[model samples]
Structure formats: structure tokens, C-alpha cells
Target: MRLATGGIMHETHTFSAEPTAIETFDVARGAELWRYAGTNHSVGGVVDACRARRIGLLPTFFATAVSTAAADRATFEAMAGELVAGIAAALPVDGIVLTLHGAMVAEGFPDAEAEVVRRVREVAGPDLPIAVTLDLHANIGQAMVEASTVVVGYDTYPHLDAAERAREAVDLLVATVEGRIRPTMALVKPPLLPVPQAMFTALPPFKTLFERAHALEAAEEALVITIAGGFPYADVPMAGMSVLAVTDADIQRAERIARELADLAWAHRAEMVIRNVPPGEAVAAAIRHPERPVVLVDVGDNIGGGTPGDGTVLLAELLAQGAQDATIFIADAEAVRAAVAAGVGGTVETAVGGKTDDLHGPPVPVRGRVRLLGDGRFVHEGPENAGVPADMGPTAVVRVEGVNLVLTSRKLMPGDLQQLKTVGIDPLRQQILVVKAAVRWRGGYGPITRHAIDVDTPGLGSVDLNRFRFEQLRRPIYPLDAESTW
Candidate 1:
């Protein structure tokens, strides 16, 4: 049996000022992406599962056009066209598997995934079994449910199990292709829920929510159950918590299970909302901590959440407070270039950040000693980015007094400890670790951090969801309205 596989993964945060262009995507199709795509240990877990079942493997056509923020309409459409065409050309296939980030929004299209699914369905025909795996932060829409036979979202927020979810989708597709089962999708969109920081599955309420959801999946008819804790930053009509169930054509049962999961998420809405501490307070608390390693999360500047990753507020605060033995990462290409020109030992004075948008904060002028310089190439060793090789683009380690700062030409999310270590910064030994990331950093750094605190600084990735002027979101949402009931 012939099979087709491909992907269009991007989590667009609408508030971000930067527009994702076509060049921003790291597209890998045919054999190149597949060689290292499913070979990583994390991906191996999924590949092994499929191998054990003796399922024939097909070449994957993956085009990952991921920007931290909203993409330009033209760029989004063109990329979608490429992905659809790539899969279509390899068609006359039995089944299809896709890996997608559910929160993507293009310029004109509100439901990007729906459009992709529609295009793929038009080419592959209605009888073909299509299964998709999505990020847990996916703002799953109704059209996504209607276009595909089965949909499964990652259970964890940091998304350590992406490949595993892909395997699950493949398994379901194999079952459908072999005529063993008929998979169908059902969706339930509840009222707005809290952001990622508040909905940690490791904690209470949400932990119980997944537990009960899993218990339901153990029942005879249920194949898979997913609760998408919607990406709140995305200002789309489909923004909110959603429950999806994949069953053996038991539409009624799937609908009932989905509603039950939605109810559970809505019931604990208050507990799931997260509040952030100011930058000054966060740094002060870190200074007071007795533990050697304290991870300070600048949630507002998180690149993973579509922020510009150039916020100088946190760095300015750290410098102002004269924090010693601290490390901070700033995504400023100009600063790195200037430092490189000045040489490793020479000191240079320059204004860094405050370039993306005026709303966050102004740039801070600092005199720093250029320490180490590198080409900025490294393979990501984190659970979230197991096999993906990343580039920091002309990186330099600059020491502003005692605080060591990591400056890069490209926007880099510190997903792994090696991201710091590669530049000669050891987070474990340092007293304070400053990361420009949201909740995803916790997967790698949580174990080493003596204390983890989410700080409210100013940037494009602001957690103040109310600050964003949303024009398309559905009305009467929670938090946006204090007294609204679902």
C-alpha cells in the first residue's frame, strides 16, 4: 500500500509585531529530512513502535515553516501550497500522517490547518485515511475536525512526546488502511482557559484532568483522547480549550467523551490561570535563594511564544542590580557583530535590543568585555528538540561587568542546557540563569533550577493577554471578561 506524509508546523502568536516570511521556514522534504527526522532517540521510540507492527514505511515530505509569531498571508499560503503539492504529487496513496502545530494563523486564513487539510483532501480524495498530530498548544478549530479522520494532540505542554504522538497517528492510519478500524474525530470547544504557564500537567487539577481523560480512553470504544489547552496568545475565532476524541466511527461516543473532557478543563479554569511577578521582584527572589542554580524565566520575551526575543528590560534590570555570576541570552545580531569587530579582549559600548518594537522597553547602553566567539552551530539536545539541528548565527559571549551575556544573530530559544554550554556558559554552576523562554524551558532546565519563577517583563510575548487588541476572537471569553460564565 502506498502512503504519503508531510507537515506544516507553526505556532503563530498574533500580538507579535514581526511577520514570518517564507525564508523563516526550515523546509525538508523527500529523503534528507527523513534520515535524521525519525532517528533521534526520542523519535526512535515512535519509529520502533511502527516497526514492531511491521508497517511499511513511506518517505515523509516535511516543510516546517515556523516563525515565533504570525506569518504573512502570502508566505503562509505559498508554504501551504508547497506542502499540499508535495504530498499530492506522491499520492494515489492509502494513508497519510502529518505533524502540525495547531496554533498557526496566516494573513487571510483564520484556520490554516483546515485550509491545508482541505487542499490535501481535494487531491487525495475522501476515502483516504488522514491522521494528524498536533502540539498541545494547538488552537484546534471545527474545520480541522471535519477535514481529517483522526486528530491527536500532544498531552504534555513542553511537548516532549511529539514523535510519540506521530507514531500514534501512524498506528491509527495503519489500522484504518488495513480495514481493522475506522477512525473519526469529534471536537468540543469550551470557554477560554488560562495560558501555558498555569496549565502545567505536573500540578494539581490539570493532572487530575489528564488522569480522568486517560481512564476514559481505556474504555472499549475509545481509541485516543486529547484535550487541547488552546494557545491564548493567538487571537483567532477558534481560540480556547478544546477536547478531541478519535473513535471507531462511533460519532456519538466521541462527542460525549469530548464534552466530558471540556467540562473538566472549564471547571478548573480559575486554578489554571497564572500570574507573573515583576522583573525586579523575580531577580531579587533569585538573589535571595540559597540554591546555586535559580532559573528566571522572562516569559514576556519568549521566542517560542512568538516574541522578538530582544527585550532588554530583564538584562537592564540584572545589570542595574549588579547581579554577579549571572548569565542572560539576548537575540541581538548587531551587538554580536560589534563585539566581534572589537575582538575578544577589547571592550565595546553599544545599545542592545529595543529595536523590535517601541512598546517593550528602550535599549540599554553597556560596556562589555568580549569573551568567546563562535560560528553558532549546535544540535539541540533537549527533549522538545531532540533531532533538530539549530543555528545561532555568529554567536558571542560578552561579559557586562560580572554577568555573562549570550548574544546571537538569529533568534535562539534556549531549549537545552547545551545552548548555554556551547557558548562556554554553565547554568548549573551559576547563581542565576536568565532564559528568554516561556514554559518549554522547564522541560530541560527544571531539574537543575533550585527555584523557578515566571517574570513579567516587557516584550512582544507579553503574558498580559488583555494588552493585545484582538479583533477576531469570539466574545465573552474568561479573563478577558471577569464575570463571564461558560
Candidate 2:
């Protein structure tokens, strides 16, 4: 059997000020795509699954960029055009597996992933069995469902199971092509908009809801159950929680289960609301807590949610509070360049962070000795993107008083421990670790963290939806509009 694979992956934060230039996307095609084979990303699972099944693989175009603002029309057209053209050239394949981020949005396209699928179907013919694996935060739409045969989403909120979900989708595609089962999927939107902080699979109402979905799957009532919390930053009609259920040639049954799960999420909407503490109070709480190493999550500067990595709100608070052995990372290429010029053991005075805009806070001037310099390339020491090599660009570490400011040239998610270790900072030894992320950092920092606290600063990735202005969202949404209802 011959199978083709690849797609564009991006998590668009429409409210964020960060612009996603075409150069930000990492594109790979043909035999060059094999580089992702052993990584823990979704594409790694596709490569691993095809190899395990002994199927001939046709690698196509794949493009992935970190969370950022919507792509321009020119960039979006180029990416989708290349993806469709690559699949068409592969031709005569038995099946296709696609890796996509469900929350992707472009300048004019609200449902970009669905648009890609539509274009692919137009070229590959309607009979091709196309299976897709999406991020758990995907805002799944009716258009996406109609364009593909099977869609599987990651089960974990920190997205630790990307490979596992990809394998599941590939297996289902194989079965569908072999005439073993016909997959029928149904979707339910429950008028809920929950933030990433509230959707951790290890906690609360989300955990219970996932348990129920898994129970149904174990009982054979559903072949696949995807509970996407949706991306609140994307101001689209489908920017809310969704429940999708797939059954064996049973559309009605899938619809019934999907509606049931959607209702369950609605009932727990209030409980799913995320509350964060102010940076000053959170730092005080972390100091008073009995834990040796507490993680202070800067929600406003969440790199995973498309916020600029240089927010200085929490860092200023940490400095004022006289916190000891605290560490924070700033994505300031200019600051790194300054540090590099000073060289190791040389004291450099430079403004760090908050350079993006006045939203995060003003850049704070600090004088620190340059401790270490690096190329900012390392493999992920993770249960997250394990075995995947990453580049943070030219990096430097500056020690300002009691805090170590690790500066990087690129915005990066704090999903792996090696990001810190590669810069000579031992995360375990620190009393407090301030990270630019929401909940995704738990996959890397959770092990050494004695406790974790979320801080509400001022930026796009704030847990409070009231902080943003939405022009495109449909009327009567939960939390955003108090009178909204299912």
C-alpha cells in the first residue's frame, strides 16, 4: 500500500500583535521530511506509523510555525498551494495522513485547515481516504468534517500525545481503505469559550469530560471522540469549545454522543473559567509556599499562545520583591547581540524585554555580567517534543542581581527542559522559575516544580477574555456575553 502525508501547522492567535511572516514557517518536503521521523511531534507519528505498517510512503510538503498573528493572504496562498500541488503530484496513493493545527487562521480565511483539505480533495478526487490529526485546541468546523474521512485530535492539553494521536488516525485510515470500517463523524458546538489554562487534561471538569469520552470509546460506542477546547484568541464564528464523535458507519449515533458531550461541557462552563492572580501577589504566594522550586507562569507573555516573548511585567515584579535564585527567559535578539559583543565575564548594561509594545510593559534597564553564550541549539529533553532538535538562535545568559535572564533570538515555547539547561541554568536548583507560557510548560517544568501559579499581567494571552476586543465572533457567546446561552 502507498500512503502520502503532510500539511501546514500553525496556531493563530488573532488578538496577538506578533506578525507571522512567511519566513517564520519551517517548510520540509519529499525525502527531506524524514528528519521528523523519531521526534515526538505529530509528523513523527505519521512517519513511524507508515514504517511500522510496511507501507510505501510518499512524503509531501509540510509547513509549521510557532503561534503568532494571522498569516497574510500571500503567505497563506503559497503554503496551501504548495501542499495541494505536492499531494496531486504524489498521485495514485491508497491513503493520505495530514498533520494540522485546528486553530489556524489567515488574513481572509477563517477556517484555513478546512480550506487546505478542500483544495486537496479537489485535486486528489473525492474517493481518496484522507485522515487528519489536529491539535486539541482546534476550532473544528462543518467544512472541515465534510472535506475529510477521519479527523483525530490530541487527547492531552499540554499536547504530550501528538505522536499517539497521529498513529490512531493512520490506523483508522488503513482500516477505512481496507474496507474494514466506514468512519462517520459528527460535530457539536456548545456555545462555550474556555482558555488554554482551563483545559488541562490532568485537572477538573476537563478531566471528567475526557474520562466520559474515553469510556464511550472503550465500550465501542464511538471509534473516536475529540474534545477541542478551541482557540479563544481566534475571533471567528467557530471560536469556542467543540465535541466531535466518530462511529462505525453510524452517523446518528455519532451525532447523539457528540451532542451529549457538548451538553456536558456546557454544564461545566462556569467551572472551566480560569482565574489568575496578579504578578505581585503571585510572587508573594510563591515565596510563602513550602515548595523549593515554584513555577511562575506569565500568562500575558505566553509564547505558546502567540504573545511576544519579551513581556517584562512579571520580571519587574520579581526584581522588586527581591526574589532569590529566580530565572526568566526573554526573546530579545538585540539584547543577545549586546551580550555577545560584551563577551563572557564582561558586564553589559542593556534594556531587556517589553520591546514589542506598551501592552506588555516598558523595557527594564539592567546591568549584569555576561555569564554564558551559545548557539541556542539543543535536543528536547522532554516527555513533550522528545528527540526533536530545536534552535533558539544566538543566545546569552545575563545575571541581573538575584535573577538570571536567559535571552534568546527567537520566540520559543517552554515545553522542554533543555531550553533552560542548554543555557547553563539548572531549573531544579532555582527557587522560582518565571516562564513565558500558560499550561504547556508543565510538560517540561512539572517534574522539578514544587508548585505552580498563573499570573495575570497585561497582554493578548490573558486568561480573561474581557481583555480583548472581538469584531468577527458570532453573537451570544459564553463568558464574553453574559446573556449568551446554548
TM-score on alpha carbons, each prediction: 0.96, 0.99
Clashing pairs in 2: none
What range of 10 consecutive residues in model 1 has the weakest lDDT sum?
Answer: 37-46
Candidate 2, residue 89: lDDT: 90
Residue by residue across 361-407, what tens digits does model 1's lDDT show?
Answer: 78889889999999888877877767568888899888997688888
Cα error, residue 195 of model 1, in Å, equals 1.3
Best by TM-score: 2
Q: Which stretches of candidate 1 lie over 4 Å from their true place?
A: 39-56
Ten-residue segment with the worst summed lDDT in candidate 2? 475-484
Per-prediction backbone clash count: 2, 0
Task: Tell me the whole-model lDDT of each prediction, alpha carbons only.
Answer: 0.78, 0.90
